[model samples]
Target: MNEIIQLNILQFSLIYLLLILVLILMKKSKISQSKLLLLGTFRMSLQLVLAGFILTAIFENPHPLFTIAYVAAMVIFSITRILRKNPWLNSSFRWSVSLSLTLTGLFILGYFTQIVIGVSLFNPQYTIPLAGMIIGNAMTGITLALKTFHESLTSGRNRMETLLNLGASPKQILLPDVNRALETALLPTMNSMLGMGIIALPGMMTGQILSGTSPSTAILYQIAIMVAITAAVCLAVFCSLHFGYRSLYNQRNQLNLPR
Candidate 1:
């Protein structure tokens, strides 16, 4: 295959033209969030540019500590985002989320890099990108689960109160919500898996192909990464909900959720 064609700065700038189409559609539709969209786009571009520089330096150096530190930062940032999105939380709930994400994110990252991919845990080339994908998905999964869990409890509070008064155990009353949250958390990953390849080439696969990787090789890596992402999302969400729901009650099994 010929070497991958590189896009010059001018050529890359042309891609921004698509944004004008988006702006026009938003204006026509009278969308109030156009400013938010523009702000998000700007932030995304700036953050990615910064990340590109950092990643370039890290890749050139290739140290274990750099990769480890990067992974730690990812987990910390993920937890921070989750917490920021959810301001109303108790100590137990906070601890649960923090521990669940940290433990599961690290655990899955190790397993995927060392076991699945047979790469060193500190190999920045593999670990850094893979960690970003795994940890980001875990963060997303937990966030969705938390949102669904809260909404479910909020909507079903009356039924929950009746069940509690009727002597139902906290676990019994909360199991459905926990299950619902897990389902909601896993739906996006599951749906993506269902439509992959046939419906659309996922980002990773498309990037690999564009970089001149053989189709078979790209396909294999894409499949492996998708499986890893799904596993990480499942384990992280499961652990977060399993331990997190308990934080909603005390030792006496009395419900104590945020108002």
Candidate 2:
């Protein structure tokens, strides 16, 4: 393998400057996301620096157990972050979302590595990054799904109650909002998959090419990763909405309007 190239402080500072300018412009436009932008930049820089050191250590050792532990930590952290962002959500709902994402992400990641990629001993090079991508995508999907479902149920309480009064089952009453929420949650993944190689060269594919992998090999990995992401997103969103419904109704099955 070739030595990794280092980014100079000058280059990093330039990117930060651009981010600040963009955030300022967004604030001027009444976007109200200045804090979010600042937080995101800080978190991104810190996480990447920590991950870089961790990856260096793992690459030196390259043990299968360490690789698995790293991936598991990523999944757990991602799920916890999602839940933390929605503090109004019940604990059970949070657990369901986390369980759903972890199960689906692990299943797809395991299958892709063992069955498709055919890597021996689940190397860190493949497992860690792939698991990161899967967990990240699943996190976004679950967050969107939960937010959308919560908003819809709260806003459409009357409609949902009317449907239930008309003899619709809990499933039937919530079907429309559930489907809409799931679709919205999965939209980003769907758009990226559809627009891959056209609107943007995906980051993974671009990195692979820059690392001197053949275009064909990079494309294969890109396609496989995209498929895995889509599957994980869909499953995560579905499971989130499925389990989230329980929090929307009470013992008498009445819709619980947010106070």
Candidate 3:
């Protein structure tokens, strides 16, 4: 194995110049995101610094219960973020989206960690990072799907009602919106796949190579991760939309979405 290059605090401190440059450019461009950009960078740095220590502890003492607890916390945080993104949501929609993301994300992460990587169930080295990647993608997938679905239905309510009055079933009325939402949710993933090598080397592969893993080994890991991410996104969107559309109605079968 090769030794990885280490970065000094000086080198790390230099990276902040990028943030300064971004803030300055945003101010000059009148983008109005200077505060947001600064806060985002600060928040990310704080979280990652804390996470570095927490993850080190977890790695040092890898227990199944601890791993499960950490993963649960991650999913809960993700669900909370998703809910924040889709406010004015009904109770049913609230629960369904959380369930869909949780179930799909955990299942895919489990399979990738245990079967694909052939690692122990609670191996922090495999579980934490892999779960992070899977959960992040699933989060984005559900967010896009929910946003598109809600916007489509609300914007096209008259058309949907027309179809319903025309004697179409709820599923039939919402099918186009569902399809459009699913497509919008998955489009980025599809494009990433199309441009994987030619456009950019993905994060996981690049990180692995930087950490001394062979290029071939890193590439294989990246491929497996991409496949898992795509599958997880598809499953999360499908599950969310499948149950979500139904939740838009009351027991009387009338449209009862949250205003």
TM-score order of candidates, top first: 1, 3, 2
Ranking by lDDT: 1, 3, 2
How do the residues 1-259 of candidate 2 rate in per-residue lDDT, one tens digit apiece? 5655777998767877788678878978999988888899899899899999999999999888899889888988998899888887776777778789888888888888899999853699988999989889999988888788778877887887788888777777887888999999889998887889998899999999877788899999999999999998998789877886676676776665444
How does candidate 1 fare on TM-score?
0.97
Top candidate on TM-score is 1
Q: Count the backbone clashes (under 3 Å) in each candidate.
A: 0, 0, 0
As for lDDT, the candidate ahead, 1 or 3, is 1
Candidate 1, residues 43-156: lDDT per residue as tens digits? 999999998898899999989988888888999999999999987667777788888888877887788779978989899988888888988998999999999988888888
Relative to the true structure, candidate 2 reaches a TM of 0.86
> In model 3, how large is the Cα lDDT of residue 208?
92
For residue 182, model 3's alpha carbon misses the true position, in angstroms, by 0.8
| TM-score of predicted structure 3 | 0.96
Give the residue spans of candidate 1 off by over 4 A: none
Alpha-carbon runs more than 4 Å astray in model 2: 1-39, 250-259
Task: Rate residue 14 of model 2 by lDDT.
Answer: 83
Model 3 residue pairs with clashes: none
